[model samples]
Target: MPDSGEVQAVKASNPGDSQVRVYAVAPRENADPDEIVDGFLEAMTSDDPGFATARKYLTRKAVRAWKPEESISVLTNAPDRDQADRPADESKGRTYPLSGRQIATVDASHAYQPNAPGEYNQSIHVVQQPSADGKSKEWRIDSLPKGLVLGEADFLRNYRSVNKYYFASGENWVVADPVYIRQRQDPVTRMDPVAQTVKALLEGPTGWLDPAVDSRFPSGTQLAPGVTTLVTDDQSTLKVPLNAKADRVSAVACKGMAAQLLFTLGDLTSVRVEQVEIQGSKGDRLCLLGKAQARDEYAPVRNAGHSENPYFVDEHGKLMTLSVGGRQPDRPTEVPGPFGKGVVPLKAVAVDREESHAAGVVQEGRELRVGSITADEELPPAVVTSSGVRPADRLSAPSWDGRGDLWVADRNPVKPRLWMVPGGQGERIEVSTPWLRDGARVESLRVSADGVRIALLVTKDHHTTLQIGRVERTFTDDGQTVAVTDLENAAPRLSSVTSVSWAGPSRLVVVGTEAGGVQQVRYVQTDGSTSATSVLPGLNGVDAVAAPYGEQAPVVADSGNDGIVRLVPGANWQPVVKSGGSPVYPG
Candidate 1:
C-alpha cells in the first residue's frame, strides 16, 4: 500500500490507454483526528468515484449533508492545518484550522473563475463517533467545507480544461465554451473524460456564454442509459448513443450535434476522435460526420485562414510585416500599400483576417483610415474621426472580426463610444455599451474571431482594467442594432491592464501589473481563470502585446527598450525589429 498522503497510480482499464489512474487510500483504523483530516484532503485529489474513500473519514451526518458538487476551492498549495487555540474537549470535538492562498473556484455549473490571491481560512471539526459496525469508537469529521479543496498542482493533475463547441447565436459558425473536467474518471458521475465532455456538450453552454451561443442538441437530450465509458474504435471513429430526446433531430441538426462532439472531443489529447457517429434511442444511426466534413460545414472562425506573419508600424510610421515561420528571413518588409509607403504617418494598424485590407490610425490618433494591403492604393478618406485634442483621448487601435467588420473605440471624454464599420467601409454604428455610460472610457478593444465577443481595456478613476463583453446583434424594423452586454472583468488580479489581445478561442494574452508589483505578461481565460503556467518569461517596458489564435504561433509585442520582440515556445523573448511599434497579428 502507498504511504499516508500518497496516491497510487495504475493504468486506466476502460480507455485501454497508457494514461495513469490515481487512487486514494481509505481511512486507516484507529487514526487520530489530524490523520483523518489529512486522509480526507488527500482523497479529494484522487480518482475515487463519488469520493467514497474521502467520505469514509466523515461522520454519517456529515456524509448526508456534504455536497462535493457544489464548488471546488483551488489554492496555490496544500493548505496548512493547525489545531485551533480553543481548548479541546472530547465531547465537544476538536477544530483544525485550514489556511491557504486561494487562487480560483469552480462553481456547480463547472465554470472556473479566478480570483486575486487572498487568504483562505476554514475549520474542520472532528469528534469521536461510533464505527460503522457500532462496536467501537473512531475519529470522524463532523463539520467541514461543503466542497473539495485542492492545491493548484493537484487540481492541474486531476482536472483539464476542454472547449465544448456551440454555434454563435443565429449564426452558422461555432464558438468555443471552455469548462473544466476530470483528467481521469469524474468522481461524481463516474464517467471518463470523453464521456464527461460529451455530457457537458449536451448540457449546453455555461451561463456566461449561453446568451451569445446556441447548442443544437434538443432540450433534455442525454447519453443513452447505462452508457458511461466512451472509446474510439480502430478506425478512430467514436459512436455515441443518445436517449430518446434526440431521436427526432433532423439531418442538419444531427450534423451540428456531431460537429459539436467532434470539436469537444478533439481537445482531449488522450484520445483520437476523428469521426463521430450518433445513434438514437433504439440504436438507429442518426448521422455520421468526419473531421473534414465538420470543418467544411461548421468551421470555427479561428481556422478561417488568418495570416501567420505579425504586422507592425516601423520607425518611419509605415506599416510592415515580418515572417516568423520556418527559416524565413528576419528582415521586415513594407506591405504593398499606401500605408506601407508612408502616404500618411500611422500610430497603429489592424489587418483583416484575410490580409486584404488594413485599418490605420493616423492624423495624431484623430482619424481612422482603411486601405488595401495587397495592392497600391491611395489612403482612403478618414472613415471615422475624433475631436479630442490629445492623442491619448482619441481613437484606439482598430480590430477586425472574421466577418469583415471593423471595431474601434473613440475615447473622447465627452462622447466616448465603440463603433463598428460594416465591411470596413460602410456607415459606422455606435455599439450600445450601458456599462460605459458611468464615466468609463474604452482605451482599446479587440473583437473575437467569431464576432460574438469583444475585449475592452477600460479606464476609470485613474485605473485601467480588462473586461470582456458579449457582442449581441438583433435585427428589427430599424435594420440591425448591436450592443455589448454583460461585461465581466477578465483580469481582476491585475491592478492595471495596459494591453489585451485574444490568443485563442477562449484565452487572452495581457500586459498588466499586480498591486505593488512590476508589469508582467500573462494569459487569462475568458472565464477569468488562469493556470499555473499562464505567466510568460519576464520582459521589460512592454507597451503592447499580440498573440496569434493558435498556441504554436509565437507571441509578438512592442517594448520600449527592446522594440518589437517575439516569444517562441520554450524560449525567451527575442528582438524582431529594433524600430517598430504597435505590433499586431491578424484578428
Candidate 2:
C-alpha cells in the first residue's frame, strides 16, 4: 500500500490571544492533532530548532500581508493608513491589501484526469476572507481528511510594474528572503493548573500511555488547531516529540544541507535520524543531515520529468543522477498518493539531477541551484504537496535573459556580496557590492542571455530605495551595472523581480510588488505605445504574476494576494506545486 495518512482540523484557544486556530493535524493513535498543530506553530515562531515542534504541512502559497500605507504603486493622491476612508482622487488600480491571515491547512489531495493520466494538481491554497475587524489572514489551517482537505480560493493579486526590480540577497551569496518571515502559528498558552493538567496528559516525549496506570484523556484529548480524535480509545499510542531523541534535523541545517547536498538514505516512515556528511565528521548512522535525509527518499522508476522532486548528487560522483541526493533540492521533499500520502523525495529532481548539474551548484553553503523542469511525468499525490520552499530569493532569482545562462544577485548573509553563476557550469564570479548588508535584500532581477541588459529590485539606499537598472558586464566584472535606471517611493514591494521575462525580443515581462493583477503594457521600442490585453505589464515583484510558473504568455494566471493560479486545462503552461496538509486517500 502507498504511504497514506489523514488530517483533521478543530477550533481551540491560545490563552490571552483571541485568535482561533483551525489546525491541520495527523497523529497515529491516542494523540491530539491540536498539540501537533501547536507544536508546528511553536517551531516556526522560535529561534531554537531543537526545542521546537515538527510540522510537515507548511502551505504552498506562503501567506503574506500588505500593510495599510505600504501597498500603493501609483498614488496620484493616496491616503495614509491612519487617514483612509475611501477618498475620491485615488487611482482605481491602487488599493492596499489587508493584513493578518495565514494558511489554515496544508494537506494532501488527489484527482485522476481520466484519459490524460495525471494526478490532481495538489498545490496548497491559502483561503482568505475578511475577519470581523478587517485584518488579513494567510489561511486558517485545520486537519481535515481526504477531500475534506479542499477549499475554494478567491481573488489573486498580480503586483507588476515596468520601471524597476527589487532582488533580496541570501546567505553566503545564496540569495533568499530574510526580514519578512511570517510569525509562527501556535496559539499562546497560559501557565495555569488546567493547562498544565492537559500538558501532563499529552503522553508526549517521555510520558507513558500505560493502560493500567495512565489516567489522561483518550484519543479525544484536545490539542491545538481545533482537532479531536475520531478513534477515541482504540489503543493508546505515545506521541514522542520529533526531536525527543535530539534537536538534530531541522529546516536550518536542512536548508544548509539542501545547499550542500549531503546526507545518507533511510526509511521515511519512522526513526528520525541525524543527517550528517561533514567533510571529516565522525560516522553516526543515527544522525543524517537535512538535505541528505530528503535525498534518501528519491528512489523511483520511469516517472519522467517531475520538476518539484528533490534529486541529490554530490559535487563528487559520490552520488550521481537518479541518486537520492539529487531528488531533495533546496527544498524539503513531499510525497502524496492514495496509500502513499506522506512526505517523500521530490522525484522530479531524482529524475533530473544531471539537468540541474548542467545549470550550476545545486547545493553550496546556504543555497541550492535548480533548473527548469520540462518532464511530462505523472507525480504521486504524495509527491505534490511540498510548499515550504519559495524560490523568490537570491539563489533562485537569477535573471532570465532569453538565453541559457543566468545571473544571480548572490545575496549571501555572512558576506554581503553578489555572484554571477551561469545557468550552466561556467565560473562563479563574486560581484562587488561593498555597500550591501544582510537586510539590503534583492527583490527581482533580469539580464540579457550574454549578460547585457539588467533590471532588479532590492531595498537599498538606507533600505528605502527600489531601483531598476541595466547590466554592463558580460559574465565578467562580477555582473555589476545598471545603465538606465529609476527608483520609486517604496511600498509593499516584491520579494524579487525575476518575473521580468521577455514578452518578445524587443519588449520584456515586468511583474509587481504586491499580489494584484493590475498590469499596464507599454511599448518596447521606447516609442511607448500602449497595448490593451495584448501586451503584459513590465517590471516589479513577488506578487507580480501571482501564480507564477513559466514565461509562456497569453496565459491567465491567478496570482497576487488572493492565492489563485490558473492556466488553460491543457494549454501547455507548466503546472504549479501546491502545499499539503492532510489529504483524503482510499488506501
Each candidate: how many clashes? 1, 140
Candidate 1 lDDT by residue in tens digits, 361-453:
998999999999999977778888999879999999999998899999999988899999989999889999888877899999999988998
Model 1 clashing residue pairs (backbone): 50-187
Per-residue lDDT of candidate 2, residues 1-587 (tens digit): 65777766854321222132233333222232233333343332232222112223222222122111121111111111121134353222112221222222111110000111112222212222233356633222222112211111110011111111111111121111001101121122321222222232332211110211111112332334222211111222112122122234444433343232221112111223333332211223222344333333321111112332222222221222211112222332322221122122221121122232212223222343333333323332210111223433324333333233444554443333455544333455555453455567554454432233344456554332224343333334655332222222222223223234333212444443223444432222111112223344332212333211223313222243322122332332222322221110000
Q: What's the CA error at residue 238 for candidate 1, in Å? A: 1.0
Give the poorly placed runs of model 2, Cα more than 4 Å off.
1-365, 370-396, 400-403, 433-439, 461-466, 474-499, 513-553, 556-587
Q: Please give the TM-score that candidate 1 achieves against the real structure.
A: 0.92
- Model 1 / residue 540 / CA error / Å: 1.9
Question: Cα lDDT for residue 170, model 2?
Answer: 18
Best by TM-score: 1
